[model samples]
Target: MKSENNYERIVQNSKKFQHSQKNEMQKRITDLLQQLTNGIHERNQIMAVSLLGAIAGHNTFLFGPPGTAKSLISRRLAYAFENPQYFEYLMNRFSTPEEVFGPVSIKALKEDRYLRKIEGYLPTADFAFLDEIWKSSPAILNNLLTIINEHIFKNGDERFNVPLKALIAASNEIPPENQGLEALYDRFIIRLLVPPIEQEENFNRLLDSKPSSDKPEISEDLKISYQELAKWREQLHKVKLSTDTLLIIKYIREELAAQFDKLSVYVSDRRWQRAAVLLKASAFCNGRKETNHSDVILLKYCLWTTPENRETVEEIVMHVIKSCGFDTDIDLAELDREKESLDKEINKELYYSQDIYDTVEMGEKKYFPVLATFKDEYYANRDKKYQLFISFNKFHSQDTFNPIDEQGNTIDNIECQFDGQGSCSLKLRGNSYHNQYTPLTFKPKIIFHKGDKKLDVNKRLIYSLSQAVSDIRKQLIDILKQVEKKYEEYQQYLQSPFATQVDIDIAVSGILDQIDKLNLRIKDCERLGSLCR
Candidate 1:
């Protein structure tokens, strides 16, 4: 009878949980965020994003030095759940599987059946935190990947479904180059930089405060059970995503892939799908039945692999978000490519030679074009030129018979001879003539001509180059206009009389700042266009 009553109680509570107002849910999350991030404004983004990722059922990785409240945030998050069953571990290179998954059951071993006692370990927890996570051994690392990715633990004969809602991991540094670590690294969808306090005032405040001893009193209204979180996740699929939201996602993905060749950054298709889910959950948690532009700001937390890449990815995503739909169709890559081709074509050089003529006395000393020909031996220089020379040659052949020792007695071997000789002098162009008997030497002088025309640059080529620059400038101007128009829209949305919502004022400023910077780039483009002309 008691068990039946308990079952009925659970049913009633679940119904109440499912029907809770969206505003109330957001309020609970916000309340938790405020308490968790109190007195630390710099790390508030990290805190808030961690909460959202956890609520969305994705793993979060905190990377920073040792003392920046990485474990504190996880503990705060674990405390937010009702009757939270938690697991926390500090891993090292020698850590074994038994330390994480719990020891093998001796009774089961005696029975020749293998099984583990996983009750108090990560496999049965509502939330878990692993510190220095990259230091784990392969034996522990492989099983860790399976549990995090599949949320299932295999214990001998049976597969046990892990009850974990969130897993928070921290590391002083990213894993060094190693094998078997990539799969574990890829399982964490959200990576955050948890830098220590940099501001003097914040640091002084930290010094004045006692190490946080008071847990935010978890009111019944603020507490979320694992079951309730599961139900809310089911509702995420029903959250409306507009066509524009999908279009923005597509554009961002393409841009990221394009930048990867130059930036050495890459994101897999699986991460992209998970990113969509996170955006949907962001909307669902913020009391909205549909996703809006604001929800996508969460993507800044989801896309980067390294801290340096984090800033770049945020810049790209914010640019897309800020454009508010006008940024599409502006393929800067293709435009830049066209610009390069024109630049190369305009600067290339060409060369040609003109023919020269010499006077040859035919009928009456008429001048005509001379086509040179060579007979016998001729030599040319490295530049393929044969120097002109003034020269003359004479040849003689003779045959004589002995004064006939009277009657045809043979003679002195028939007496035959041949001889040749020549006189020559160098001739220079445009010099006082030492004219030889020959009027011309049949050597045509070679001359070279060079200019822009040799490069094939004409009015048509210049006009095309200038036209391309104008087109690019026009494209940039169009994008700028859209950015300004979208900013105005965002302002009106924020100031609307019916607005009773979490204002996206920060995102608004971020987008406007991005637009302003884009306008500056447009000015640069204008200067570039003029130079191209």
Candidate 2:
């Protein structure tokens, strides 16, 4: 009797050990998931439910199109729980709810059990998959929604709830259009768009993956019993929320509202409540009770469900990340370019005013001829070569002639001809033909060399002086233009090289850094894709 008792004790001990091993494995899985993603509220939703399913002994929806590895996530979730009850469906137009919910357990119906026999499928199964979920009709959609949300199936007056964990719905497109879209779309608490494997290099890696064999049915093995999940469901609900994470989610919703104006967003009281569950679960999965940033990306993953929203869903998520906080890289160059345009406009309007033409033309007409007379001593003291002169003195000597109006009446004080008010200027600008006589050079040469000792004398200069005075005016204006050109060159030298460089260089450097940082962030993402591939 003692020996028999020892064998029974050993058997009982062995069973306890197996149960303990399962619990330990589950705890480890929960811990591993917590570290894998950022704890953004959105991500926390995905993580929470994933763990909730493990605890609750249910499955989750791994949504999105081909190559995004939507099904892979489902498989991983099942693997994580060490629960073999995870099932996946790549749905189509022909798929019926019964196909996923299981045939009314036809064989059992014969046994007089009116129950849709719930032998397998979603109602009785631990986890289930439904791909292309939107393709189904309102009847099917409504049935599934009721089951997913309530975790209960109705057979006539009888209601049966199962240990359904999570429903990962996948789709290549958005929820169908029409009035019913809202009703069905609202069921997916967490929507995620799985994009194609990015980068051509990752293509080969995906191709190499032997598509997982028909996901071993979710009913094969379920570790956490339904009773155990219910025990922790309240605790999961009690998960703490940090103030910062809440603010971020609110901000994301606002931002999405702006970008996704076409599709209306009406997050219910339930969504907010669930979001907390997700945030907490995410922390739990990663072995953390505290939320953090890495889980944020998972939240982005959830916003996609319909094919239409996939692009915008990811876009909204990335924008949050890039813009969050003070760690942003600014593109100074683009800013400077925009700013510099304003200055250019000001310069064009100010100094380069259209009114300058009027000013110049009006100034030309305002010119008054001047006249002057000076002693021979005064003339000799001046640069003889400037036989060229400003002739301001011409004003003093000129006879002022007054001009008349059209009626030839004297316009006193107005410088009209009848009033004898116009002024003629002559400052003896090196007298040209003041008297009809021999060239001035001939007289100068003869006076200087009374004896015939002539070296080459610039006789042509005398001829030049003898020429008409109008020709001299033209030559003087030409010389004035050359002086203006030189002045402009000097101004350019003062303004360029260093003065302009310092300010622009700083701004340009800032812009370059902005572009550089964005590029680096993208590269890191690409690298992540490589690792995933």
The lDDT, on a scale of 0 to 1, for candidate 1 is: 0.65
**lDDT values for all models:** 0.65, 0.46
Highest-TM-score candidate: 1
The runs of at least 3 residues in candidate 1 whose Cα sits more than 4 Å from the true structure, single-residue gaps closed, are 1-22, 39-41, 324-533
**What is the overall TM-score of model 1 with all chains considered together?**
0.60
TM agreement with the true structure for every prediction: 0.60, 0.47
**lDDT score, residue 20, model 2?**
41
Score residue 179 of candidate 1 by CA lDDT: 78
**Which lDDT tens digits does candidate 2 get at residues 342-437?**
334323422233211111112223212212223343334442221211222222343433423333343342221111232332222234433222
